[model samples]
Target chain A: MTPETARRKMTGTWSAHSPLTDVPAAVDTELAAFFRARHADYDDIDPVVADAVGALELFVTGGGKRLRPVFAWAGLRAALEGGGGSLTAPTGPGDVLRAVSSLEFIQACALIHDDIIDQSDTRRGRPTTHRRFSALHSERGWTGDPARYGESQAILVGDLSFSWADDMFADSGVDAAALTRARQPWRKMRTEVIAGQMLDIALENSGSEDPGAALKVDVYKTAAYTVERPLHLGAALGDADARTVSLLRKVGREIGVAFQLEDDHLGVFGDPAVTGKESGDDLRSGKRTWLLMCALDRADRSDPAAASRLRTGIGAVETDAEIDELRQIIVDSGAAEQNSARVRELTSDAVDTLRSCHLASPFVDELVALAEQLTERRS
Target chain B: MTPETARRKMTGTWSAHSPLTDVPAAVDTELAAFFRARHADYDDIDPVVADAVGALELFVTGGGKRLRPVFAWAGLRAALEGGGGSLTAPTGPGDVLRAVSSLEFIQACALIHDDIIDQSDTRRGRPTTHRRFSALHSERGWTGDPARYGESQAILVGDLSFSWADDMFADSGVDAAALTRARQPWRKMRTEVIAGQMLDIALENSGSEDPGAALKVDVYKTAAYTVERPLHLGAALGDADARTVSLLRKVGREIGVAFQLEDDHLGVFGDPAVTGKESGDDLRSGKRTWLLMCALDRADRSDPAAASRLRTGIGAVETDAEIDELRQIIVDSGAAEQNSARVRELTSDAVDTLRSCHLASPFVDELVALAEQLTERRS
Candidate 1:
């Protein structure tokens, strides 16, 4: 079938301001086929390779909100239809789906490596990559240190995922010129995420409590990497003009920050059952989230004793009582209410920017809906 | 200047059977410029990022044989001129230099990550990437474990290098179509090298005594990764035909194995001053090199006592006396002689294959010279 008809059929399921559910489903389908083929290739090389790829496949297709791919899809539609371009000979929806699906591999590489760096034992409630490999080493009664073997294999696996992400994108069957265009943002995204990671460790080690420092981390680690760049990459793929790209980035930045704020809020206040993680873990770890910074700042100005108590509590709180006490202090200092208000304001500003811009229809509407879903969700 | 004229000038310094000194020098120059620009870009982001990139710059430009880039250059030359392609409108020599220089970044990533895996303290007589960062952490009196901080930073730096390698190759100013053509082998090469690394670690941990298994490690770890794929990538970049690419890979695989065998030989016997490392270090570490396998195989067949002695000595030798005795046992068992003979046979066979093939010229001669230098070098 022609690309236009395929696109029409694909979009038929969507209604005004509805979630772009088809994008995530399409991305997952593409990833499944991609991994199956990769599995065969790795098996050809060695069973050891196949094992590594299998772990990566599970981590990639296992669970994700597919946020990056959704944004990329919206950006493409925004450019081809919203940016006043006729839908003449647009890149095929299938090809776009395949290309954006490659983003999941990038996410896989990032999280796998990040877990090793953070010593995070679990992700999405499953054993993190290194931990999984460590368990394998123990189960098989392998020689040498199991932890060392696990970390080493995880490093290689992460490296493999990073390489595969590039290969998958390049071979996503997009036109050569369009692929070249998309490469600009794709390349920048990889570097930014890694650099952001470096910044994170540095911040932790330096004991920097500056909220600005934490926000800078969020801008690079989340705002640009998660939202702005994904949109830019899709826009580039669609051959969108510079103005539209800039506006989308601005909108993306706001939405991304709001999404991150909501996540930080959940890390502190959300239900453990709903989020699938213990709330206050961030407080116990003394992660320099913006929410914590806000709380500290407000309490320091208004009530020095409470601020001191909060400071001592971070990275030291163990019992539920201590965590609850810290949570009360944040709420009493008005930081919790402020954080929620900020999320709402950011979402509103992003929608305002989208509405003011001359960007095309259904995409602008879809992005607004995505923004709400991301920032307003409880868990 | 025009590409043909530039090519003539570049090749003017070469003499038949002489080292391609120009290739390494050219690659280093390109890498120097590349890193300088990347350094600035990172600086623009944040000081922490700038610091990370600085460390990568030092490690990447520090030292190595630049073997991969040289082979890639030879392969490209072979395909363009030796594969009977006319000199008309060849890729600019400068662009080719920049493109091949990207391989050093891959090598950098491999060695940096490998050092972390091996817990190696030094590389090329300098602190390894992780150690360098670890030193910085201690000197700065950073919080948390210095070792963890160092390893985490190194992982990110290695990741950055890997990402930069792709960007450098993609933006090498090569024609878009040729870039697309190069992507196939380039993608495969990345996967193969990482997979090869996985195989290497598995072999070490499995405690397998089979020489065939050792040979399999050499094939993937050394032959395909270090040699065959570099040549294939270069040939693909030059748009060489399938037959020519196949012939080049055959030559590459043979030469690659011989080079690795030479390295193994040097690791055990070459002078520390010459090879810049302690002899028998590999033996002390009990690395499963082909030479070790050969020693075990022959000793097991004829002299069970000698084989047992060798087995017990590995991973346990500490004093100089123990290492000397083990080396003596290897030499007396004739495994050392067998290894040297195999290296010679492999080199001879590779040259013969090149001579028998109907592939293009000057490159054939140049590759033969490279094979001799690689396999016959004392260090």
Candidate 2:
């Protein structure tokens, strides 16, 4: 199965040939059951705890691309099918689904905490966890500052999400040895993502404008957890050889970078309705993304005045016209084109690597399809 | 050893007869090594990440009772010594130390987040994590709101602490089966502590006058993670039988409640130099502690005027004189006496349960000593 065939297959309903065809639905089902059981347990403990879990359930089950879990599933399938034999301690599909779905809770923790850090009011066109909790405090006319109340609760909610993710993985019923093996990448992913966040804060705070610094953050903050480690975790769980895991990690890193590059493009150029976020938000917030970094670098060398204007506009411009001017600078400097080209190059490299590795049929094809979808999507 | 002998031994340097004599130092050593390894790894990733880990290392290794790890260690020793013989997969002392030391990171998470929630300036007479980070931002002349920047970084630090804790536990070198058994109570403890925090926030916000509500928070927020579940985790790690675990939990719960009750007394009466907290902070902050609830209830019946004054002063009083007045009201209403009496009764009951359980001699003695220290400490 080539990329073209894989693309065509994805365009239509997934057939039996696609091993991960039911993954998204299956993950949803598992998460729903998990939350339902958690709700009952929390209620047994205290109404307040139950309410916090309810908020988390609403936020988690609300919306997500389920990309991490899908990648993990694909990694497992590739490892198992490519190995030419079942592992001594095999992971059944049910256990795989449960284990992979746990990633979403980790994602939940990331997003919940991210919103508080960014002081973001909305996520996916809905109030973020902190905002929603804040509103609840206000609506109930609770004593003390409502904002503080909201943030504190959201903090606890985020902590609970993390704890739940660990619990779910531990209870996934995978054999102890497999679970032990899986935990290696899982632990690394946890530490890297968190350290990535700290690095981001420090970078932004220091106002460092180096494109290299921005890319370094992308490697840890987005690439590792988003793609590489999830795949490594899956491969480990399947008892894949270290060589195979290493190859998958290489592919995953490339795809993860490409995926984030695409997101950077969307943050600047995509339609708000499609992206569920205002275009040029990265510029407005001065996020120092790779695209912005490239624009600044290129502008500094060739268009000094434009570079000056971009610097002045970022994190200061509020009006649409001002934002539009900054966007024009990014485009006129050829940074936008470069960003898109990099995404394509990275994605192609990732697909080529996956193909050359000779992973089992259909699993390799599915991974190629995923890489294309992630790096090529408009939103 | 009986409580009397246990108390006397605790007053002296621990002897060889004491099984858990070296627990605190052993835990400190393990944690120091863990942090050093983490620092090197974080440095390999990036300087910013390394700095963040450095801050966490300082904060975690700074100061605390190491009570949770000590209790967990005692629990393990009791189970191993009392169970007649080792299970097929016995945990070595080294593995046990590594696993138990991970609790301090969890404690770090709780304290760091608690400071953020409380908007506290200092913890243990040093600037809190958020304050420390905020000061760093200000010193660096960083962009954006310094206070928000501080909080955002602290939130990430708290998250990193939690991830580090889970990672440490996973890499604790414990037998896989033991890790699996330990995770049950570990999972419950994590959830309960976070949920307990939410409950405390909600109860405080709602101005709930019920002593039962305060007790509920104690059961989840402090008691469960701080004592009962740590003991349970140790027992599980030691592969103790179900009946022994149950008995330990029973004893733990009683001691835990007694411990919190004593903390309540100290909150209002202990010296600031000793407790490292301003006396009557619980009253000043309007924490719905059991002591406050009892005082409010007794005052409402005996002296409605005093009750009205207490309500008005709570959370509003700032001066030493004002806090002193509130303290007087509590003592006059007999709440303080009742609180002390409850602590004594609970501690006695816990010791009785421990004696009746017939656990191996010195482990039980160490536990009894620990219970007395915790419940009777000035701090």
Proportion of native contacts kept per candidate: 0.88, 0.92
* Residue pairs in clash, model 2: none
Clashes of each: 2, 0
Q: Pick the candidate with the highest DockQ.
A: 1
Worst 10 residues of 1 chain A by lDDT: A12-21
How displaced is residue B162 in candidate 2, in Å?
Answer: 0.9
- Candidate 1 chain B lDDT trough over 10 residues, lowest sum: B12-21
| Per-model TM values vs. the true structure | 0.94, 0.94
DockQ for the candidate 2 complex?
A: 0.79
Instruction: Please give, for every candidate in the order listed, the TM-score of chain B alone compared with the true chain B.
Output: 0.92, 0.92
After superposing the true interface residues, what Cα RMSD does each candidate give?
Answer: 0.8, 1.0
Candidate 1: chain B TM-score equals 0.92
lDDT string, candidate 1, B259-362, tens digits: 98898888888887788777787888888888898898888988889899999899889888999988988898898998899999999999998887776556
Which digits, one per residue and each the tens of the lDDT, describe model 2 over residues B10-74?
47533223356566665666788898888766778887777678889989989677888877876
Candidate topping lDDT: 2
